[model samples]
Target: MKCISWNVNGIRAVLKKDFVEILYALDADIFCIQETKAQPDQIEVDCELYPYQYINSAQKKGYSGTMIFCKEEPLSIRYGMNMEEHDTEGRVITLEYPEYYVVTVYTPNSGDGLKRLDYRMEWDKAFSAYLKSLDKPVMACGDFNVANEEIDIKNPKTNHKNAGFTDEERNSFKENLLAYFVDTYRSLYPEKVEYSWWSYRFKAREKNAGWRIDYWLVSPELKDKIVDAKILTDIYGSDHCPVQLDIEV
Candidate 1:
């Protein structure tokens, strides 16, 4: 199956761009989106290919949210981590199939000056535990909001203390998620340099100054099934481009 994950930044905004066109072009079996910034009622995707569409909107309007579009109906669907504090943001959505569970997450950003760093740390622990509790193998994807290693981000020296590149967040990601799951792209191509996200300022995308924050991570047992993982940098319409995963599952 082919699965694609992208942080659209805002669903409504991307819809005005190439969202629908890209959806048709990629033709993924499952398409996961993050940072929807819209309510369930507000999202109007015109694609007829995906009859099963699920959205997890935040309590606050036009805020962090996630959505998934699948051609086949899942056996079950779950929203959030079942933790009230974290669920309010509509950051997580899990779809359980017969073979495996597919989870899409919009991890909280630490915020300017790292004001929410403490809460982010707490979220990491809870999110990790939630994934571990799943009964079947998992294929989790989305904008994790953290660049795992120096190689994952451009100019690591200048971004050391930044929100997504901070040492604390990196360490937490390693201990929390990487310990249990395999990062598909990095696992397949350790030395490959590619990025999924780029700053909107200073022509960062044009200069190729970007960070590989978005990912497709799977359970260790599913690691060998990973056929191909890619960062579709050529695609546009959002600050973060789409990441694709091809697997037999």
Candidate 2:
């Protein structure tokens, strides 16, 4: 199966770009999008090709949101972890299939000056627990908001204390992986320098000054079925590019 994840930044905005064209070009079996920033009624997404569509939009208008579209209908779909604090942001969605569960998340970003770092830490712990409690093997994807390792960021030295690169955020990501998930991209290309996200400022994308913050993490057992995990940097509509995963499932 071909599964792809992209943080479109804003669904309505990307729709004005080549979002639909890219969707047709990729022709993925499943597509997960984050930072939609709109409710279903607010945007007209003509993804009739993908019969199954699930959306989790934040209560706040034009804020964080996510959605998943799959050609194959799932057995069940869940909007959030059933936790009040986290559900309000419309950050997570889980679809259960016969073989495995597909989850897409839009992790909260620690605000400027790391103002929300403490809350972000709490969120990490809760999110991990939620994933661990899943009944089946999982294929999780989206913008996790953390650059994980030094190699993930363009200038680790300068970004050490930043919201997404703080030591605390990185360690939380590590703990999540240690729990049972595998970073598919790193597993396939250990030393690859490709990135999924870039700053909109200072021509970061042109300079290739980006961070591999978006990911497709799967249960350790599914690692063997992963044929390819790649960052599709060439495609553009948002500041973030898409990440693709080819698996036997």
Candidate 3:
């Protein structure tokens, strides 16, 4: 099966940009979107065919949010981890299938100047614990918001102090993924420098000043089932591109 994840930046804007066309182009069996930034009533898309959908929206209006659309019904659905500190942002959603748990997450950014670095770390720890507790096999995908390694970012030296490239944040990211799952992209195409996210200003996208902060991570047991994990770096309707994983589900 094919699963794709994208952070549309803002659902309303991308909708007008013909996100539905992009969605059709992808033709993924399942699609998860981050930063939807819209309540269901705010924006409408053709739903007769791609009808299976689940949304976890932030309590605050027009802020962080996520949604998943699938080809078929899920065995069960969960909105979040049920942690007050984590659920409020509406950054997580899990859909259980007969095979494994498919989770889509939008991790919190540490913010510029390290203002929220401490908070981000707390969130990282909690999120890691939650994933580990799943125990069952998992295929977790999303905008992690952290460039895990020097190879994951465009200019590592320049971005060292940036919110997503800090050493501390990278370490936390490693501890989390290394604990159980592997970054499928790195495992399959380690030397590739393609990126999924770029800044709107400063010609970041044009110059390829981007970061591979988005990912598809799978449990060790399912590692061999992964066929490919890639970034659709050229699809530019949003600041972030779509990332995907082809797995033997």
The number of the candidate with the highest lDDT is 1
Tell me the lDDT of model 1 at 45.
98
Tens digits of lDDT, candidate 1, 34-122: 99999988999989879999999999999999999999999999999888888999999999999999999999999999999999999
Which stretches of candidate 1 lie above 4 Å from their native place?
none
For each candidate, what TM-score against the reference?
0.99, 0.98, 0.97
Q: Give, for candidate 3, the lowest lDDT window spanning 10 residues.
A: 40-49
- For this target, which candidate reaches the highest TM-score against the unseen true structure? 1
Comparison by lDDT, 1 against 2, better one: 1
lDDT of each: 0.96, 0.92, 0.89
Q: Which ten residues in a row have the lowest lDDT in candidate 1?
A: 81-90
